[model samples]
Target: NCGTWFLGRLQTERDVARVLDGLEGAASAAGNALDRSEIGTLLAGLRSRVFLMNNAHEEGHLLFHTRWAMSYLRGPLTRKQIKLLSPSAPEASGDAPKPAKSAVPTSKSSRPVVPAGIEEVFFSSEPGTYRPYLAADVTLHYLRASHGLDSWEKHVILAPLEEEAPWASAELLDRGDVDFSDDAPGVAEFVAPPAGSVGTARFRSYGKQIRTHLYQARPMSLWRCKSLKLQSKPGESKSEFASRVQLAAREERDAGVEKLRARFAKRIQSMEERRRRAEARVDREKSQYEQQKLQTGISMGATVLGAIFGRGGFGRATTAARGAGRVAREREDVQRAEEELRDIEEAIQALEIEVEEEARAYLAEREDKAAELEEVVVRPRKSDIAVMGLKLAWKPD
Candidate 1:
């Protein structure tokens, strides 16, 4: 099952493997994809919740967690490692896989060479990629027939430890077997928002590997912000000139985003108002007619020409006509309003997409412009050590 908070008693080995492998795989594949700032905010809230749970208990295991809870901890390093012993030379650009054998060193080079055993790991600094190691989480709960109503022990692991770390190295803050009990519920629950948000969240279930719904960012490049300055005024110091350029770039980007938002704000508001009014009109019409028709339909008609038999055929006919008219009009008005609302909604969505695309384009253009303003001089004025040292000082005695 899905979206369940209680992942009841799990006894199968398959369940344990599913939760661990699924989360690791997700973390590896989603390298550098999630929004770090937003994720940090959410994780902070999760920590707070965990803190409350831990405080509820007096001792034993301070954390509220099951045995399989370890899967929620540190994630495997998804980044490619630079091996000290490879048969082939390392590639200059992207990270390359290690060769079967170490390559022969043809010459002494400037790059530092690592000695025999230790390997250099190129860890990515990007958040949500390989950043926090632990890719996703699964909440598990166990219960038995002896338990009373709502008195079952609930387990939630706040964080995970390194997979192969020494048992004595750290205080293991988790408990319970992967599948704690045979009578546990076989489902998990999670919140999955729609696509076109700032960042996407991916998660896997402990019972079975569930392909989680991902929320895609709207593709706005507003986050890639910087100040860019091209030229300096006469007699300005190099640092001052760079600062001025940066300030200008920032102001330009801010103004551009604000302008684009303003342009679409009125249109979006008008469309929403129109949709609301259309729906309200349909509701008003239905209320005035449907209620009366429903009341008449449920009652016995008054006696007419067939009064002796206690049957009023004319009254029945009149009631039928009124009821049918109400149904027909209600259907027509509702259908029309629904159609209008759909159109408005579609229009609003289109505009939103356009805004996101436009924002991305504008930011990209600004970034390119900013890049042109930068000039990095990595080479020194002099190659000799002494001359390089001379250039660093205030220059005169």
Candidate 2:
């Protein structure tokens, strides 16, 4: 009886073996060869992963495997590796069926239905005015000390927040919402939720996510990006910082002109190289065309000689002359094609040269500007000034 106790474990092992056998059968049917040892390894791997579950509600054993688990057991899969015969693992083939698309309701009369597991919350600073929007799992990060729920009203423009909405059940008392001044510490603080109101206080964690989303969604045009660099101090105005930043950026840009000039020079050189190659190719084709024309002329000379000799050769000679003339014409046509190619290439070169010269001039101007900037902005050392003063003192003046 004691020896038979180990037999119970065989059932679990057998179940795992059966699953492997099914996989092996499928592989065989598909003409995929699998060795017996590999099948045994697969079974053993699945069995080894099994764990017993014990709880107050129930007690049983469960088997679980994952991408990481399979990778750990069988080593990493590489492009070079091929599966001769394999088990039906999700990762082996990305052929899992996708969920069907849900149909959107067409009728305007349909009530707004929030998705399952999502919640719609409304909060307002003013009485009788509430705004509603959907959020997914708002409390997910609330347990942590540094995390809390963020009021959606801050970032999201709720329908009620708009200037007009006739159907809105809630109305805010104050129409004059404060606008945060630019170059200021807190434009958002004016719109801040009334103190002790649910709209004001937020869970730090959710608030961080909401703020991140708002910042990301904000219009990110080049002008907006440049305008975003406000003064570090709260008291400083945004316009003041904006002007300083603009001037500094202009100065930096002026200094970078030398690099731009080098870029233009390199581009011009590359364009010239390409032009040469295209011209050479066109020349080679033209030479082939000339050879063809010469061959045709030689044929015509023989035909003319045959015609002068008379007898049975006259008719053939005339036909041959006509063919030769056509060939020469075609050769001329080839020459014309080459000329067109040359013209096109020259046009391209002219355009490229124009572009390069313009770019060079632009860069040179910027470089000159930069040189001026260096002279004006980069102050000379005190030692140099002192030396200059001594030289002046020693002079006749």
Candidate 3:
């Protein structure tokens, strides 16, 4: 019973270890000893049932596992069971299988062929929520079609669930055409009927197994799908392309910064020129003020001498007052020019700071976008068949 429970629920090697620990702890509490060899055998059996594969993508690499259906281990279903589960199987009272009412012909002929190539397929439902049984022939045809003349081997790369990383691995199904047939070692079938009344009616009338396969076990929340090519072009491997993508993103970020700086360059230059003019005006005003002071001193000294000697006294005194007024006016002009220069300098400094901040923001945005970009290669043709429980819909990147 424990073995059966473990087989049904344990999804990872860590889960298996935890189960073993619990079993050992229970045995100790019951005053019984657990054998190491027995534990080893159990682990070996679990390994056979679970498939662990590496997830190689832009995201960090991780190991995740998915268990084969329990039926795979139990052995092939009896002929009677097979007949009952088969889409074309006779009804319970030995009545012939009902013919589909649609004009579309047989299901096999109607099903679309799997496209040839490495396609990044996506699912609308969350992982592990639904597992549908697809026809083995369609999957085999896809593998054969995708395989090259020189390289006839292919594998179905299963990405880890969004929440299954770091602590676990991804799943890999060997796509060898011969090993996935109806009678193959790890393939099995189970009866799964459509859920709602409308779906059931459609399935029965149209013999639409594909729709039933997907909608029967779909989740409440719907998700969008995206496709990315593993290789951008011929002669490029996935890793190489990924590296190139990173390089391209970096280049793009730098170019954006440069563009932004170029945009602000003229304005900054113009402000600096205005500031220089302000400074030059301030200098000219200071020079005029100094000359005015000198003239005022000479006029005052002459006025003082004329007053003491009583020679041209009234005229000299009037000229001294005029010189002093001129000096005061020059001083006020100097102060105004200095204030204008200070204001211009401050404005230029503020503009430079704003440009730096804007450039930093642009760089950050580019980095965030780059992090989300994935390297993908080919777009496989969309098909109705859901190979290994995943109906892959390809969307262009």
Candidate 4:
């Protein structure tokens, strides 16, 4: 009799009701063959089994096309709808008998209530949970192969849920109880990092939390990509490698700056030496000019006294002319020395300005170089790589 039963797709409540009606009619046709109680029992069993089978089939179908189905559904099926569709769903109506109350006080809070004896788990973001489908393996494999990411043992992908499903909350997709291991054969597990963990900051940066849902999958748009590369040394974690690369870059930048400073310091020192020499020459010339001036004063006085006393007119005249000429020559020498000193000071100032400009240019160059260095050496974390894979999964073949 079970083998004679026809199985057809039951996608809607009307479809299920129609099927039940057909079964009831068939039972009625057996006049006096079956009693009322027997008929009720038979219909109940058939309805229960049929609903169970339908729910299982629908779940499997959703799982196989997890990402696509989520995109289409936009949000999880409402509890009322699920209850109507799933025969095993708990009754919520007042007519249904209430379960026995526990000793714990029940609050009317919006937070989910945990059953007694079960540990309550909290997520930093809402746990947007989804069931893994059969096609997940194939999708991951295709991602790994297409992206040339065979070296990584595992990946965790992050994609923006807001873009694909606007009604869905911004949250990390919850990979419920999925354990990720390096030895595992699949590309990655859909597990969330524990709250307050090292890489959890990366997740929070996106400002999305997962909402509790029966069906979930990675979004199509990639939010971030993380991956590991061939380690420079043995037993290096991705975090450690990133730190090392950053340290090396900082060291390189510092070394370059120091070298530039040292080079400029040498040039400045040479200019300072020239400035000192010029100052010394100016001082020496000043002293010589003063002496020459004093000598000329004394010679002129002597010449005036000699001429006034009529001791020697031509000799006094010659001495006065010589004194005047010597004084003028000393004054010219002092002026040249002072001019040289001014030129040296200006040159030193100019050199200082040049050093500052060059230093600024050098720093800018190092900043650009540091960015390039990060791009070249730094690799993303496992979650980032997983996000990339998720993005790749949605790409057309």
- Predicted model with the maximum lDDT: 3
Candidate 3, residue 357: how far the Cα is off, in Å? 1.4
User: Against the hidden reference, what TM-scores do the models get?
Assistant: 0.33, 0.25, 0.40, 0.40
At residue 237, candidate 1 shows an lDDT of 56
lDDT (Cα, tens digit) per residue for candidate 3, span 21-100: 76666555555565533343334332233421211112111122454555545577899987777768444766757775
Candidates sorted on TM-score, descending: 4, 3, 1, 2
Question: Which tens-of-lDDT digit does each residue in 277-344 have in candidate 4?
Answer: 88898888889889988988887888888888989877877877898898898889889988988998
Pick by lDDT: 2 or 3, better one: 3
TM-score of 2: 0.25
2 or 4: which has the higher lDDT? 4
Q: Write the per-residue lDDT of candidate 1 for residues 1-397, one digit (tens) a residue.
A: 1211222222333443453344334444544132323222222222211311111112111212233234453555434433332446655766655564222221111112211221222222222211111122222222122211111122222211123321122121123521122121122221221111111112113111111111011111111113442434333455665566667777888899999999999998998898788778768766755775665555424323344565676776677667667677776777777787788889889989999999999988986776454332222112111100000000000
Residue 266's lDDT in candidate 2: 76
**What TM-score should be assigned to candidate 1?**
0.33
Candidate 2 Cα outliers beyond 4 Å, as residue runs:
1-281, 371-397
Which candidate, 1 or 4, would have the higher TM-score against the true structure? 4
Q: What does candidate 3 score on TM? A: 0.40
Supply candidate 3's per-residue lDDT for 324. Answer: 99
